[model samples]
Target: MSDRICCPLCRCAEVLLSKAYPEQAEVLALLREHGPMTASEIRAKVDKSIGVTAINNRLERLRAFELVARTRYGNGWKYIAKPEVES
Candidate 1:
């Protein structure tokens, strides 16, 4: 397989895949399914095989990319998927 990574926004193959941050895709997929969730909720939805820290890191990256939005809910924050608009 090629090392090229597709941009989740434009779906273009311009994004250089990062091995250091490999869990991004999986996290995005999960968000697409069960987003608008808190970090703990996300941890619960994810496979028990993965580490909690890894999921948190992936969430941080996703938030930075604006693929997900973090909202303040009570004392904690909730993550929600930023829907892509079809033109």
Candidate 2:
């Protein structure tokens, strides 16, 4: 059943981030490549024209799955990917 799916976007959310949402997935890939970085840093590093607020919002959404982590940096937060957990 659809309800059995771990993610509505991907039946196998564990392995299919890119397929679930390519644009949003880019945020994840970017963090993986850059390590910990502020939302503004992430926005600048990405290829698209998204706003910093949007990047911050995406980071929050990604946090729902523990796909991302955050640490206080200066007066704001830096987002980073959680260590990949293999099954």
TM-score of each: 0.65, 0.75
Task: Identify the runs in model 2 with alpha carbons over 4 angstroms from their true place.
Answer: 1-15
Candidate 2 lDDT tens digits, 1-87: 122233444446634766666756788878877789898888788756788888888899899877888999999998887765433
lDDT by residue (1-87, candidate 1, tens digit) is: 123223454554113323444467666666667657777777787788877777778888888877778889998778776766554
Candidate 2 local lDDT, residue 28: 80
CA error at residue 19 for candidate 1, angstroms = 7.9
Clashes of each: 0, 0
